[model samples]
Structure formats: C-alpha cells, structure tokens
Target: MASRKKNPSKARRYSVKEKEEILRYVDSVNSKQGRGGQTAAVKKYGISALTISTWLRGGGASSFKIGKTSSNGAGGVIAKLAAVHAEIQAKEKELASLRSQFEKLKSSI
Candidate 1:
C-alpha cells in the first residue's frame, strides 16, 4: 500500500457527551471480551489508546475543566473575582486598624 500523508484537518472534535458514548461502547466491548480490551476498541474506533483508557476508567463525560478554560464561563470567573475582592477588602480593613493603632501611639508622644 502506498503511504499517504496524515491530515490534521481530518480530525474532528467530540463533545463530552459524544466522548461518554464512545467510552460506553468501549466498556461494553471490554466487558464482553473480559480483561481490559480497550486496545482493540481503540484500534476499531480509530481513537488513541489513552483516550480509550480514560473512557474505561470513567474519566470521560467531564466537561467542567475544559469549560472552565474555554469561553463558556465569564460569569464563573466574575464570581471568583468577587470573592478575591471581598478578601482584599477584609485585608484592607485589618491594615487600617493597624495604622489607626500606630497613629494613636504616635499622637500620645
């Protein structure tokens, strides 16, 4: 067979749900075959062995981390920012109290 160049453009991005479905299929195959047969499923599905392993291990169906890094949640980041802000406010209040005590000692002299 003639060697053909691999095309990166041919790769398709799968959603978390789709990955879960693929993982389910892998698990079904593994259960029927006995032992971890994800290698076979990986070859059959044209997916990487690591991906199959992740699916079999129940690490699939998780979009939370990916979604956090993606453009899906400006709101969540804003909430985090608010929490940081509240913390800074508390620290500023403590600093002000310390400064007030320093001023009181200086004025007594």
Candidate 2:
C-alpha cells in the first residue's frame, strides 16, 4: 500500500489576539453598513464563514468549544473529541480492509 502524505495547507490556526482583531473589524464594518460584514471579513482575512460564525456564537476564541451542550447537557468539547475519534477509527478500519484486499490480489498474481 502507498503511504498517505499529509497536506501542509490543510488547516490553519489563529491566535486569540488575531481572532479578536478580526471580530472587531467585522463588527465595525457591520455597524457601518448593516449586514454581510462577515462575508467581507472572510474575504479580507481568508478564513471560513463557518469559523467566524462559530466564534460569534461561542462568545470568542477563549470560550469557543468545538461542541456546545444541548438540552441533555451531555455535549461540549468532549462530544466533539469523541466524534473525531470515532471518525478516525472508522477511517482506519476502512484502510485495513483495503489493505487486506490489496494483499489478497498481490498473492493471487
């Protein structure tokens, strides 16, 4: 099986200060011209709209949690982490299955 290479430009992390600055800029623009400032901000900062919305809804980067609690009170960061772990496990299982198939074909040849 060929090895998978990590993409260098996959995800980017921004510092708290940078996020605050971007939020402030977005606020200023929105206050001046009404709505759609988030789109403008995304274009200016090269960040995703969903990320900005998360920051807005989560009350800034410091309090930002990947998953927020629901009515059941069994969510938040822990839930997000668990979800990611499950995804990784599923992907690994698929990879193993593919590898087994490849090995079977190689031996038959």
The candidate that achieves the highest TM-score relative to the unseen native structure: 2
**Model 1 C-alpha lDDT versus the unseen true structure:** 0.64
TM-score of each: 0.38, 0.50
What lDDT does candidate 2 reach at residue 9? 83
For residues 3-83, write the lDDT of model 2, one tens digit per residue.
999887877887656877888878888889998778999999989999898777755433433434421123555665687
Instruction: Compute the lDDT of residue 89 as modeled in candidate 2.
Output: 100
Clashes of each: 0, 0
lDDT of 2 at 3: 96
The pairs that clash in candidate 1 are: none
TM-score of 1: 0.38
Superposing all C-alpha atoms, what RMSD in Å does each candidate have to the true structure? 10.7, 20.0
